[model samples]
Each structure stands twice: as C-alpha cells, then as structure tokens.
Target: MSEPPASDLTARARLRMAALRLFAERGFEATSTRAIAAEADVSHALLRHHFGSKDGLRRAVDDDALSAFDRILAEFDAPATRQGLLATFGTVTARLFGADELRRNYLRRSLLEGGAASGELFTRLLNGTRARLAMLSEGGDVETGAIPDSEAESDRLWEPYQVLFLMLGPMLLEPVMRHTLADPVFAPEALHDRSAANQRLLTRGLRAAPGDTREP
Candidate 1:
C-alpha cells in the first residue's frame, strides 16, 4: 500500500487531538464524532474515514498517550543505581505530567471512569512497575535491609500496587489537590520538590546504602 498523503496524516492528527480534548472534558459516551470533527475543523465523514468510529478514534488516542510512557519505561530496561532509577522517575514525572494538561486530563478521565480501556491502562502501568521493581531487586540496585524477612512475603507481593498508588494518587487527584491546597502540584518547582522528597523517602526508608545515616 502506498503511504498516506501528508495532508491526510495532518487531518488524522487533528481529529485525534480534538477527540482527546472532548473525551477529557465530556467523556467518551457523551462526546460525538461530529463534535470532534467540528473541533478539528474537519468533516464528520473525514473523521470516519480516518478512524472508522468513535471507539476506534479513542483507541488511537489511547495508543498515542501510552506511547510516551512506553518510552519512559524503556529507560528502565537496563540496570541503573537505585538513585538513578528514582531520578529518572522524578525527571520524567515532572517533564511529562507537568507540561501536558490535555494528556493528564485524558488519562485522569480514562483511569477514573472505569472501563476496559482503563483496566488495560492500569495493567500496563502495573506491569511497568513490576518490571522496574524487578530491575531494582535483581540488579541489587537497592538494599532492603530496612524491611524484615518475616514481613517480606506480603511486601514483595504488594509493593508494586503500593508504589503505583503513591505515584497515581497525586496525579489523579491533581485538580482537587490543587483546589484544596491552593498549590500547583504539577508546577516545575513543586514537582521538583516532590521528586526530591520521594528520592529522600525511598533512600532513607528502603534503599539506604551501608552505613549511610539519613533521617527520614
């Protein structure tokens, strides 16, 4: 098959962006292809021509949003020091979520609305978390001397979920959190502080190097 014309690709991208915005604002069931087409300044027939249906368009949007995290996840495929890993998390979180309101809102809706797509997204996140933890554990990137073996079984089993909750809590709650605290949680400075605090907490609470005295 021949490659699509450049104009066709541009129209497709516009439709996807429009769909993302509408879905974030009004949700999937409420938003229509016509509205998306109007938002993109394209015809409804063009939307159908590119993505077939609203659901197909949504899948395209989901795939595009998830691709960013896939790149972030790929960074963990190789071994790194515990701090290096944590630094990556901090940097990426600040960079990714802090800058992209549309993507963040889209994800918040997708995750909280509860659907097959949401479940799939959560599963992808869980798998990524597990892979990162495995790297930390198997590569001896972090020491778990702070945790006792007597309780290690359950901790090992549930750590990924726990970590994800910690990571996602602020993200999902960012709007409410910002309202309640009167703080911009995703601001660069705030994100940097949060990341630094996370690094400190993980370092002292879980991955302290030998004889390193750090107060939690």
Candidate 2:
C-alpha cells in the first residue's frame, strides 16, 4: 500500500514516530532531543512545541502503547460475568504480545532498564490498571470467591499488574524464553492461546490449594 502523504501527518505523529525509532535503537536515557529531531528531520523547536520536554515525549510514548489496552476496559464497562472478564482479560493479554514493534521495544526498555526514567511511566500505568479494576469490581465484574477472603484488598489490586508483567516475558526474556518453550512447546502461532491460558488462570483467583507453596 502507498504511504500517507507527509501533509496528512501531524507534528505530534512525526515526533512520536521519531522518538519511537530513536528510543528503541538508543534507549530512552541515551536518546537526546536533538538526535530525535535530526532523525525526524524537524527542528528542536518543533519537538518542544509539541511534547514540551523529553519526559513529556516519553509519557506520550507510554500512553500510546497503553491506549489500546485501556480501550478494551472502556468498551465493556462492567464485564458482568466470569466469561466476560475472561474474554476481556484475554484481549488485554494478547495486546501485550501483539503490540506494535515500537511500543513493544519502548516498553521493554522502560521496564527492564528500570530507574527514575521509567519509574513514573510504570507507576502511572499500574495506577491506571488498578483504577480500571476498581471500576470493574464496582460494576459487578467480580463475583465472590473469585478472590479469597484472606487476601487483602491491596493484593487484589496488584493482580492485573502482575499479569501485565508476565505477558511481557517475550520482551523481557527475549530468546531465552522462546528457546525454553521452543517451537514445539509453544508454537509461534499460539500467541493467543498462551494469552488465553494466562487469562484463564488469572481469572480463577490466586487462592492456593493444600500443597501450594508459590506465595512468598
């Protein structure tokens, strides 16, 4: 397909595209505004005009990555049944694995290269997930027994973030996880199946059975 004309693109789009390429290649900390500007073929003033600062640009990148995931939550306000929750959860998990290359690399770097640079982004992302979970619970998405009485409300809140991290294994572990699973164990086309499996377990709650020793 032919590409869209440059005239059809916004300054923010250009800057974001430049930032994604530069950050993925150079890491967020190492990439400078000047370098991004040069890559985008735009003046530094334009970057400032649109994103305000490097931090602002990085926030935009994270928001762009999360936008799709957030949209699923928005679409199904209450997710009234277990199946609804599972299906929605499945979609969210799939997005993490199937995210666009730029988003995948940017988030991988932000999460693995953790420091002050990514702290704000992860915090914001987690908090948003928690808020959405709260909404779901309030809307009756969660049924009793889905979570045990012994677990604190705080622990329940972190469940979605835990799932988020697990689904990101492809980026965090790279070839190691792929090699460990191998093609036979987890076929390349089984990404959605893997995501569905995660949702099934996650939606089932964290209560341990008699021999369970997984909890810290």
Candidate 3:
C-alpha cells in the first residue's frame, strides 16, 4: 500500500470538514460517523477522541461556523454614507456565500429541508439580519433616496425576514437555479458578477419607475 502524502491540514480539521460536507449533502441523521472518518482518512477512534461523538461533532461544526459568522457580522460597521451602505452590504453578502461550501450548503439545506434545526437556524439568521439592518438604518445607511419611497414606505417595508427569505431561498436552490435559469446570471462560477448584479438591483427598487407603487 502507498503511504498518504504529507499535508498541513490536521486530522481534526479534516474530520470537521468532512463531517460538514457530508452533513450538508445528506443531512445530519443521514450522515454516519463512519463515513466522516472514512472521508477524513482517519480512524473512527480518532473521531471519537476529537469530537466525543457524532452529535458532538455536529455541534462543533455549528460552533465553528457560528464563530466565523460572528466575525463576519463584526465587519459590518454602521454606515456613514450611502456608499458605505453599499460597501458593507457587498462585503457581508460575499462573505455569507464565501468559499466555505460546507457552511453554505448546511445553511441552504437547513432552510430548504425544514426541521427543528431549521427553525433554530432561521431564528439566528433572522435576528442577525435584523440587527444588521437596524444598525444600518440608525446609522442612516439603509435608505439613501436611491429608491423613492411609497406613501407608506416606512410602514409597508418588508422587514429583514423578507430580505433573508429572498437571499437564502435562491442560495439553497442554486443547483436547480443554475440549470433552470439557464442564464449566465445564475452562473455558480461567477459569484462576483452575480453579487454585483444584486447590488445594482438593491440600490433601485424593482419597479420600472422609482415612483411605481408596485410592491417589491
């Protein structure tokens, strides 16, 4: 048998990554500890040693990802200007959909395939998004006259819940969207372009005219 090549990634990290990927693809109940160990190229004993148990491993992934999410939120500063709003939104959006496919997939599946866990995840996401928007609103970054308001604009505005639903739904259905949309707009490989496109739309209301009374 050939020896495995040397690599910098630790066994524990590999296990966590593998667990994340498998859990995202197969959901937590469907994924097995044995599969995680095999995917990580480590012994099952090692998995037990590092994580204590499969449930513990799941918690670890959640803890690690949430910790990173906290840092991402920390990057969102109270905006001093409309430009600042755009910059902050762009940064947060890109980070949410960053290279961490495991976190992204887990989040998407949790939303799409609802369960008890999905409710918890949604609560966390909704609170975080609301806080982010509130901070921006207070800081005078959320509205910049880019989109003229409706008569009841302030009262009729969809809250952060609606915003998150809009953001996460498409993300969870990306694979379907990629083929179904059949446009470069849905290109999985071109997230930069996609985010840029989103930025533009967000600045202006979806209405053909800024004063259009249609709901967004």
lDDT of 3: 0.66
Where does candidate 3 have its weakest 10-residue lDDT segment?
A: 1-10
Clashing pairs in 3: none
Query: How well is each residue in 71-152 modelled by candidate 1, as lDDT tens digits?
Result: 6555553324444455456556556777777887898998999988789888987887778778666765554446577677
Q: In candidate 1, which residue pairs get closer than 3 Å at backbone N, Cα or C atoms, i.e. clash? A: none
Index of the highest-TM-score prediction: 1
Query: Residue-wise lDDT of candidate 3 within 17-83, one digit each (tens)?
Result: 8887898889888899999999999999999999999988977887766666666766766655443
CA lDDT, candidate 3, residue 150? 73
Local accuracy by lDDT, each model = 0.75, 0.66, 0.66
Q: Count the backbone clashes (under 3 Å) in each candidate.
A: 0, 0, 0
How many clashes (backbone atoms < 3 Å, residues ≥3 apart in a chain or on different chains) does model 3 have? 0
Model 2 misplaced stretches (Cα beyond 4 Å): 1-7, 77-90, 146-148, 152-155, 183-188, 199-216
Q: Tell me the TM-score of each prediction against the true structure.
A: 0.77, 0.74, 0.68
**Cα lDDT, model 3, residue 62:** 74
Worst 10 residues of 1 by lDDT: 76-85
Query: Candidate 1: where are CA atoms >4 Å away?
Result: 1-9, 76-91, 132-156, 206-216
TM-score of 2: 0.74
Q: If both were scored by TM-score, which would come out higher, candidate 2 or candidate 3? A: 2
